[model samples]
Target: MSQFSTPLATTPGIMLVRVGQAGCALRWDAQAACWRWPDPQGGQLYAWPAQDSMPSGVRLLESAGLIACCRSGRVLLGLGKRLGSVELPAAGQSGRPLQAQVLATIDAAEARTVISDGRTDRQGNFVFGTANTGADQRPIGSFYQYSTRHGLRRLALPVVVAARSIAFSVDGARMYFADATRGDIMQCAYDAERAKVSDVRTFASVPAPAPERGAAVVDGAGMLWSVQGGALARYDADGHPRQRIELVREPVASMAFGGPDLRQLLLLGARGGLYGLPAGVAEELAPGVADTPFDDGPAAVVDSQRPHHGD
Candidate 1:
C-alpha cells in the first residue's frame, strides 16, 4: 500500500512505470530506449523497454559494475551485448535488448569489500564506494573515482561498512554520502577540477527508526530526495528538512529523477512497486538522453493507485 503526505497531495501529477527490485542506480539509456537497474536478489542487470513493454533481464558476467552490497555481481557503465553495433528499436517494436554488453570495464576492488553505492560526478566520471560486507561489517571500504584517462584511483578517506546517499551538488562542488549504520549523512567539499575531496563533516543525521536510507538524488532546486524510514524525505542544501511524504509502509529500495525534462520523481518501494510524482524542478538533462532523438516512451497512467509488481 501507499500513503502520501501533504507534499504528495500538492503535486498531483503522477506517472508510473511498473517495475520491481530496482535496488539502486536507475539510469536512462537513450540509444537503447530503456531504463536500466540492477536486481539485488536476482544477481542480474534488468532493462525495461519503455513504460508499457515487458522488462528484459540481462545476465551478469563474472566481473563488472557492482551494487547490492550483500551479494557480489557485475554492473554496467553502458548497456550492450558486445555483438557489435546492435541498434535497438522504439517501444512496441521487436528488438528490445535482452543481453547487456560491457562498453567499459574498470578495475576491481579489494576481496573483502563490495562496490555498494555510486553515481557520476558533474563531469560524468564514475564516483563510487566499496563497502565491507563481512558479517561483522568492518569499516574497510574506500571510495574510488574511475575515468578512461585516469583508470581507477582510490580516495584518501575514512572507511565505512556500507555506503548510501551517494550524490553530488548541482555544480558538483559538494558530495553527500552515508554509511547505512552511521546515522549521519556526511558532506565533503568536492574539487571536480582536481578530483579531490576534503572538509568532511556531518550534513544531516537520520533519526531513530529510519537510520537506513536509500541512495539520494539532487533536484534542480539543489535540494535532496532520499527514502527515509517509511516515506520520502526532502532536505535543503543546508540539510534542513523541507518536507516528507509517506509513500510506503517501508523504506524505498531505490530512487532517481527521470522522465521527460527530468521532473518526475521515480521511486521503488521496499516491498515492491514503482511510483512517480511531479517534482516540478526542471533538472539538467542526462547525458545523451535528451539531445538524442528517441521515441518518447509512453504516457504513464496518472493516478494515486497502489502499483503492483508485475511478471
Candidate 2:
C-alpha cells in the first residue's frame, strides 16, 4: 500500500475537488454538494459510490474554492462550509444551479480539464481550456476568452492547441497553461485590463507528456513548478529547467504549498492519496485572486454522510 493510505484516519479540514478514483466531485450544488458518480446506462441519478470505473482513479484534486469540470459532464463548486446532507439534480437539461452562468460551452468532447481564472475585469473577460487527450482522440482544443457582453470568444493562438494546467500572472496580465499533449509549457499575453491577447510562446517543455491533468504553481521566487509522472519539475522565470525531484509514485494531478509557513510541498498521487515532501527554499505564492469570476464562499467542507471507499 502507499504511504497516503494511512493518513486518511486524520481528516484534513480543507475540502478538495477530487477526480479519477471514485468520480468527479463538484461544488456548484447547494452548499457545495457532490454526485456519487455518473450512471453507465445514462441513468439520471447515480448511486452514492458510483460502481462505474473512472480513468484517473481518484488522484486529481483542487483546493475546493471554485468550479471545475468533472469526468461525467458535471460542474462542481466547493461550499467551504459543512452543510448537512445536500441534494443535487440528476444530470439533464435542468439548468445549472448557481449565481454564475456558463457564458460559453467548449463541446463536451474537448473539455476534461477546467480552471476558474479567478474573475474577469470590469469588462467581464475570462479564460478557460480543455485537456488534450491525444491526436487519435482530440488534436488540440481551443483556449477560450468569454465575456458577459461579447459571449464566447476564442483567444487566437498561432495554432489550435489544447492546454491542461493553467494559471495567470499575479497581475492577471498574461495567461500560462501547459500543453500536456506536446510536453511544453506555454504562455499568452493578455491585456485582461483591455480584454486582449497577443504574443504566444512556448515557456518550457518536459521530457515526457504530463499524465491526464498535470498541476503547476508559480512560486514567490518567480519560478514555475509542474508535475510530470512522479517528479516535481521546476523552471526559471523564462521557463528554463531549474531542477526536478522524484517523489514516491506517479501523480494524478494536484499540488499545493501547505505547512504552517506554507512551505511544505503537497502532492496528490494517483491510486494512492496525498503526500508531502520538502523543498530547500520556502517560498510564498502571490495568489491570483482577481482572475476568478465568482466568490462562492470560504469553500465547503467534505460531506461525510456520502458513501465512498471504506473510511
Candidate 3:
C-alpha cells in the first residue's frame, strides 16, 4: 500500500527519539509510560518518556524485576507492580549496577554462548534464545521460554547459532524468530500452555545483516517488521514482502513498536544514534492497525528483594 511505503517518515506529532548504545529489546513499558531498551554493550537499561526530547535526558531502568541475560543468568530486579522504576544516571552516563538477585546460575554449558535476543509472547512468557560466542560463531544455540508461573522451560525449536528477531503475532498463535546466518526468518505454532511449538517452517528469507538481527516486531495487524540488511521492511502475516523502507543509514542494532497507540515505531542503534519512525497515521492506512498498546501482559518478573547469589 502507499501508506506502507513511507509510514515511518516525520509526518506530524512525531519527533526523533534519541537513544543509547546497541539498543536491544526495545519495548514500551506501559507502567512507566516510556520507551525502554537495553544497552547491549553496557549491560544496562535506558528509559525515555514517550513525549520527551533529548534535552530531557533518559532514565535508567531500576525495577525489582527480572531481565534475562546470558552469562549473568536471569536477573531478579523485581517485577509485577513496580515494573518501571528509574533510578540510574541520566542519558550518556554508564550508570551503576543495581543490587540484583539471581534466580538461576549460568552453568558451564552457557559459557560459550549468550542470549542474543528475546521478547515477550502474547501470553506474557519471556521467549529468548542464545548464540554461540565461539570463534567461528556456530549456530548451536537453543531457545527457551520463561514465566513466573512455570519458571523457565526450553522450547523445542531448532538450535540456531544466534537467535534474533524473536517476536510473536498479535493473536499469539504464531511465533516469529530468525537467525540471519541461516538466511531467513522462521515461524511456528506456539502453545503457551505447553511451552511448545509445531509446524516449524520458513516464514521469510529477508537476508538481514549480522549483529543488526537482534530484534524485530509484530505490529497490531499481525504484520512482521524487521531490518532487512540495511533497510527496514514490513512483511505480511504469511511472510510475504509488503514494504521495504530504506534509511539514510542502515539500522544500527534493533527496533520496537511503542507509544500509547502502538504506531510509534522506535529504531535503536549503537552509540546514541537516532532513527526516524511513523510520526502520524497515513490516510491510506486508514485508522491504523488495531490501536492497541505494546503490552505483553505480565512478564517473567521476579522479586528484587530476594537474597542475592551467584552474581
Model 3: per-residue lDDT, tens digit, 1-311? 23243344422222265544454445555545565555545545655674555423332333321242221122222232222222344446754565443433322334676556666676656676677777887778777765555555778888877777777877888888887566678899999778978899988754434324546778767778776554556777787767654445434455565565655566665444545445333323311223122232344644332211111
Higher TM-score: candidate 1 or 3? 3
Rate residue 105 of model 1 by lDDT. Answer: 28
Model 2 residue 89 distance off true place after TM-score fit, in angstroms:
14
lDDT of each: 0.54, 0.41, 0.55
- Who wins the lDDT comparison? 3
Using all chains and alpha carbons, the TM-scores for the candidates as numbered come to 0.69, 0.53, 0.71
- Candidate 3 stretches with Cα past 4 Å from truth are 1-15, 55-96, 207-212, 278-311
Q: What lDDT tens digits, residue by residue, belong to model 1 across residues 1-311?
A: 21222243322223354444435456555445455666544544556655676676554433223321100122333221111012223345554333443322222334566666777677655567766767877887666664434445566556788767787887778988888766678889887545678899988766654456657777777787776654566777788766665554335666665555554556665543555654343232231212112111232312111211111
lDDT of 2 at 190: 72
Q: Which structure among the candidates has the greatest TM-score?
A: 3
Q: Which portions of model 2 miss their true places by more than 4 Å?
A: 1-103, 108-126, 132-135, 147-150, 158-161, 207-213, 258-264, 279-311
Q: Rank the candidates by lDDT, best first.
A: 3, 1, 2
